[model samples]
Target chain A: MSLPRHVIAPAIAVLAASGALLRRSRRRQRSRNPRPASTREWTRHPVGLVAGREIRQRLRSRSFSISVLITVVAVAAIIVIPSFHHTSALRVRVGVAPGTPSATSALITRDAHALGVVTTITSFPSVSALESALHRSVDLAVLSSQELLTYGGLGASGSSGSNFLTSLSLSLGQASALSAAHLSPSQLQTLQSAHPFRIVALHPPTPRRSVDPLALVGVIVMFMMVNQYAQWILLGVMEEKSSRVVEVLLSGLRPVEMIGGKVSGIGFVALLQGGLTIASALIASYAVGSPLVQTHASWTLAALILWFLLGYVFYSWVFAAVGSMVERIDQAQSLALPFSLPLFAGYIYSIFEASSTTVSTLYRALAYFPPTALFAMPTLVSRGDVGPLGFSVSVAIDLVTTVLVARLAAGIYRRAILHTGSRVRWGDVLRRGR
Target chain B: MPVLDISGLRRRFGDLVALDGLSFTVASGVVTGFLGPNGAGKTTTMRAIFGLVDLDEGDIRVDGHPVDAARRQRFGYMPEERGLYPTMKILDQVEYFGRLHGLSRADARSKGAEWLTRLGLEGREDAKVDELSHGNQQRVQLATALVHDPDILILDEPLSGLDPTGIDDIGAIIVERAREGRAVVFSSHQLDLVENLCDVVTIIDHGRVVAHGTVDELASAGQPRLTVRVEGDREGRWAASLPGVTVSEINGGEVRLVLEDHVDTDLVLSAARAAGRVTEFSLHRRRLSEVFRESLS
Candidate 1:
């Protein structure tokens, strides 16, 4: 998937020009309305200037635009391709042994219809003939007065077919027993239509284990986006430091302003790309009439975006601080390993937990922890396992932790950014006071 | 009043002391040349003035007030290691720095364009910084520092890697900025160039200011030297034997002599004329290189 040079060249030019124009307009507007001297004076501070530069530089970058385009294309493909594949009608083939009553064939067809699977039935003269027919074209086989054989084996278990087939076989067995007992048609009908015994519980029952495809997609997207964009913030900081551009910037701006502006700028770009990708996917799904849209809709989408933002904010500060401690890109990689451990743990844990109905106490606890909450809480929310109290608690914890981490990160960044060398240790940066 | 004043400044990087009680004053409307050997703390002093490096025990005052972020923003600083976003256009990069210095976007942009044009980078503003030649990139770096119309400009090694033309262009800009009543401070190893461009020279060695004065004041502190050129004597063989005069060199028809204290310079001039025919006789002020080398030693 490579684009032609001529196409890429013009596209790059247009993007760069538009970005420049947007930046120029914002700067002009800001200049036109200088804030009065007050606490709000920070609005016209150097932080905004630095952030504006970061945003303009990143938005116009070739890698950023290319990655965004790829994400949109991938999301569209995921939605549209599956819809095209499952568009045709689904049919199950049933083979009946010769002399097996026509009524049984009608029963199987009715059951399959009730389950929304169309049926094609065939009869043969002997059991061996029926077995051969089953092997040749049928999804399941019925031997006269004997057993139900499926592609899974001679038994009815483990076969990929409708539950209607299992119920039909059980009903047939009961019908045979009633006939042996010499029951009349009215008695048979009564037995066939009889309701089962019911068991009630004092508490609402937990839902059965089932995979929510939307939850799986949501968690995965959140994990990838948080990790990817956080790394971008780290790399951007490292580049500025190693290039010694930070020295010039620090001469005019405070360290806190520089770090704040950078993280916010990159974070905004991340949200834009993520939002565009998700929106394009939804549009594609709607165009293709994908069941995904019907299943997840807006709630899950909103949770995914919100959680992504929380996760990005939580991680980007840590990354930016770590980025400031290291003078080179390679040093950043080695130092980032510790910072990224929790993100990786949450990502892997959420993916494995997304489909399971019952989760461990550890997994539940992680839903409240800030580092993992971004990954864990979203899955729990999508599954309806999270209550209002739990959601609020998790959000509160995450918010508090983000503020603490941001302050800590700012402190470290302010101290270490000026001390360029092999790599500034965390302990050293923390120990050095303002 | 000095636009920038530093006193008792001290900075240590672990075991190495980069600055030791370093002090200097830069007044407006003059080019103050900051001269130092490598590792002599000229850069450290400049960075301290802008609060880039935290001082161990001293204060830097700008316009009679302690330096702060707002005051520093009014000062332009160019580090020894030039840094600019390589992928950004020349004009945009300049304007960005100007904005960082508190100029509005419109002001920064117009000022950026004006500086680029003034610095002979008019047509290359749209080119990426990396796309320009090394000298042109240096020009853009200068434009970034100057676009805000700073009250005080501190440039560290601004002419380290430029051709003669580039050096002259930058020197002219420094003089122009000073002429506009903005104090300009620049560091360079090229002593003669500094001597020609600066009204005052502050030479530091081993993290301390060894000498500080106007070029003439410093040069005339010691015994005066004289260069006497004779038309008839190609080797100047007749002038070496004069009393109280040491002939530093006799190249072709020119004789360079250092006069000791109380030596009659009239006798030396008469001796030069008596040797043959006097073509030129003039007092030779001490060159900045000689002063710098003397200070370092």
Candidate 2:
């Protein structure tokens, strides 16, 4: 059918207009709805209730307030102290024959100066003297004889002779160059430039991401928050049962709500603390002018938040579930210990992976496990070990794990909350008492 | 309106049965005492009504609508095992629980202050629950349950550890609430208070209803028996001679008799008068405790 431009244009315009209108209407509806809950609506609004209760209650406590203040101060000191006081660049002492190779000597001083190493060349009388000077904390030593280079039972003819030959060759080369060249400094510069070498990197290709200090910081913070709040989840569950308040709480809330609320509550607080820490860290890092953070902080922050969420979902459930095992606070200590080990492993692996991303088999296995998934994936993503699809798949797997663990924890909590003053075994909580 | 009506409820806790076939109605404008001894399932009954404990069968309704576990926001209940965050300030704790019952923060806070003032805890609202004595903590527990303006109040051992003055204060509050046409049911071992406080009483023992009715009606449920303390002819022997009457115990001049439901009290008395001069003559009826005991047995 032949269509006129005016008719077709109006039709297309109408279609576009409807699309815009629909989007606007949907946005309006969302704003109109008072409940800000997500599609993955947390079962634990009560847990948020409980966690708000705990944090608001305990935030004013002598311990909580004091500890946070102290931590901020300590972190500030740690960041500031090393940068200003690192005086290792102040000076370097060297042992070299003064007259034997003036060109080499002059080159050494200039190169050392540029590197921020203040150089002092020494005129040693013998090879032994040069060795002694080298041993006396000189940064570098150049000798005319092979004796200093060759060490043994004061023996070995070939080694000693070759070392001396090498040393004499370097010194003689310096002398000839000085004679043939323009100035002593210029000749020394030539000798120093003769041995330029490439430093071969062991790290694999990571072109998509440049190095990021905040990424490491983000990983550390995520690991810490997950572990800290997991303990809170454990302790909260234990307290509900211990104080015999779960019965009352459970009356209005479901098992899912109970556990979900707890983890959500503690997780919310952890996130709050984490956000504050990050903001302050960025502010401080900004103030001090850290180069990596200045460039990639936004990326670091976004990754951190993602990792924090995934990590919390992964670990918080198990902690809540395990915490359900102990009706008494004392038993909770022992019950929580096994869960702590994975967190410990997560912490260690995260730190190790920060410097280099040679992830161990254990960490790879842990990445598959729910609790440590948050911890492992962030490290992988930070160091360029993960691609987009793989990252998403890992997150999808973690999402499934979160669901399963949530159900498992809820089941465990529901059964044991009523059974006070005794430990609830994992087997019983899962298998039958369910 | 009858605020709460629970019927045909059954619940068990592994091997041991907590409640079996329990039912009762709590009416507005009156205080109802749920009387039971230790392990008498009073707490379980309260919990079951609130859906605090899962029921194996039957239902509970509030204002004629079923009180589902999901609809628990309708009722206010104080469990036997009382709890509050030891670290939370009294005002915050009360307001928090009020909010849980679905009050806005501002509303809850204001209502919390009002209730605290009403509870005579005006100055101590900022104090932590742990700082309060057990009696005051009990008061805080009460404030938390009622701060949200709930229509139904179910309390298990509401006055378990209150001092005499504390008891009087709480009793006055409960009485005031009841006067305002609220449905209030509480279980207590304090018989005197129960007698003074409740209009309707439901007594359970060994997980079964023993006696349940108005105070006077429950007392008058059994047939009247006459106890005659006489100084003349052997009263016990004479009482045994009466139709359908059995003389059980004779302590000095005192005589106890078991009379059939059909036996006339006047006939037994006349016979006792003919046999001896009655020193102490009165209609012997079962007391509330006695009625409970007899029904349970």
Candidate 3:
């Protein structure tokens, strides 16, 4: 489950580059008419060029930048806010008169420590000075031997403020009683240091919730990312078809190349966005010392990344074909809504299952269903509910299905793209093969 | 030898036949005008040549070989529905198409720039297609088609929606490409322009080629027509007594008469002379519009 991203990332890049270069070289050699030596040059890979255009356009778009920024900020807030609250609540500062007794100071420090708070004590010139420093320089102050002063009288019940006040008051009251008893310094020390009776539970409580935070988070990210990127492919193809640009493109490119280039171009953009989101989460988790990153994180992250890619490829082809059938944006949406049902079903089910301690039988079956597998399989991987064999089988099924889907989509796209009078019906196209 | 040969092209969209055994040859160094009414299968035939349309029955050949993807790369097409990437820069879009046709990046860029310049889109290479005027977008569409310097140009209504200057510029480019040894076949309803610009004309109706020949040949194919202009007669009242001499057109003092094959030219001349002093007399073929109308019928 732990992927070698560094090795795999660069290896995939090198392979893509090699394929492009090989295609260019082969195309050049295949040219029936060779130009003069001065004019001879290698043609670039068409899919790469098409993909490059998509990448450049998307990268430069305002919406893309804005979306990434928003995602990063939202992710940072989700991680950093809880940590900030926990650290702030445990910290307290106290002010006292200059001549305050050492024993009283020790009692205050000991009480705060027992309450699981970190206290900072400072001396002022007089009682007036100590009182004045309350809630400004310190949260609380010792105005006199008999009185304790706080700006808001210890905060609401069950808060860290109320807990600290209760502990400090009991310690101070005990010290005053001991002074009246005229106990010796050794006796006083022993009394103050005496241990409280331990209350042991007959039955220890276990955590009621067993959700895997990473899996839950992964499901949400995969759903949003896949849905978003798939829509882009749909819209892009719709633009080409509605504008009648496909005719010119088809004149020069095979339908397969066009669809392949389009999916690849947008897929890379989606990958970049997914990578950024993952990286941000990792960095923020590390910075805040969150326990969410501690359990099976590497493998879960790898699964999320792998599934995102498979999910995107599977949906993009289906969306692209739908795009080609309609000439208007509204028509595209209407047609795309039905095709998007599987994505929604998978997403909703994955989210529900990701939050449970145990995976359901239906969820496991859905992992093998190509459309829902994009969501269900990755969630299973993240939760450690699926083994390597299950994961591999799902991946293999998806890949084979993707190839078949791609062929079917390309065929439909080729046949229906040029029929402009009305939205092409899928049934008619399939039956007639027009 | 013909640069492009489309034979027995047939396509059916359900019950409607878009192309019915359409056959035609387009020779290099000649501009062939494809004439057809709406839904007469011109677009279908053109699309078939580029492999854009799957013909149920047809064979398209280029340079005596079957037209495949490689051969298609050497052909430029301007569809009846003009389209370009609205968000893409004109030069980049053109170059993208050129590269798609297998031109090197550098070559595509260079050629794209050259085509844009030739199409009078100079100084606007960076402008997006959506930012251009309708005529300018049309120019950009043509630039995409011509950027690869294709060997065969199949343009569907290339002259539609162009200003006179735009028309002349594009019309000249079409003729120039053909003169440079590229086979150019363009479909248009503008018969006058086609008649003036095309070297050969092919007229199709109901998806079949009804007439195919040189401009002069098709115009002169049927029975000869005699035109007579009388000094005093503003109408063709002089043809009343003449048999097998039917008036095809009469404008002012001139009368264009469609004569029977056995009709005597001397009798028509004597009849016109008897009515008024014969100022003009000549025999010539019908006009292209007339030929086109006749072929459709």
Candidate of highest lDDT: 3
Best by DockQ: 3
Better of 2 and 3 by lDDT: 3
DockQ of 2: 0.28
Model 2 alpha-carbon drift over 4 Å, by segment: A1-51, A73-223, A245-261, A279-301, A324-327, A352-357, A425-428, A431-434, B226-258, B262-279
Candidate 3 to truth, TM: 0.81
lDDT of 3 by residue, A1-434 (tens): 33344224433553565477557745754474333343233225556767878888899898888878877676767777878776454777888776555567898888787877788888888888777777788888875575777888666888767888887877777777888798888998898789999998889774344676676777777888888888889888888987889899888777877888889989988888888888898898899887659656776677777777878999999998898888788898899998899999999988888877677899899999989987887677665566655666677688778878987998898888888887888786676455
Task: For candidate 1, write residues A383-414 as lDDT tens digits.
Answer: 66766666766776776688789889988887
- Retained native contacts per candidate, as fractions? 0.55, 0.26, 0.60
Against the reference, the lDDT scores of all candidates come to 0.79, 0.68, 0.82
- Cα lDDT, model 1, residue B180: 92
Top candidate, metric TM-score = 3
The collision pairs in model 1 are B234-B252
Question: Quality of candidate 1's docking, in CAPRI categories?
Answer: acceptable
Between which residue pairs do clashes occur in model 3? none
lDDT of 2 by residue, A319-405 (tens): 888777786666877887877887777777767766663656776666566566667766665555655555556666766666677
Candidate that beats the other on DockQ, 1 or 2, i.e. the better one: 1
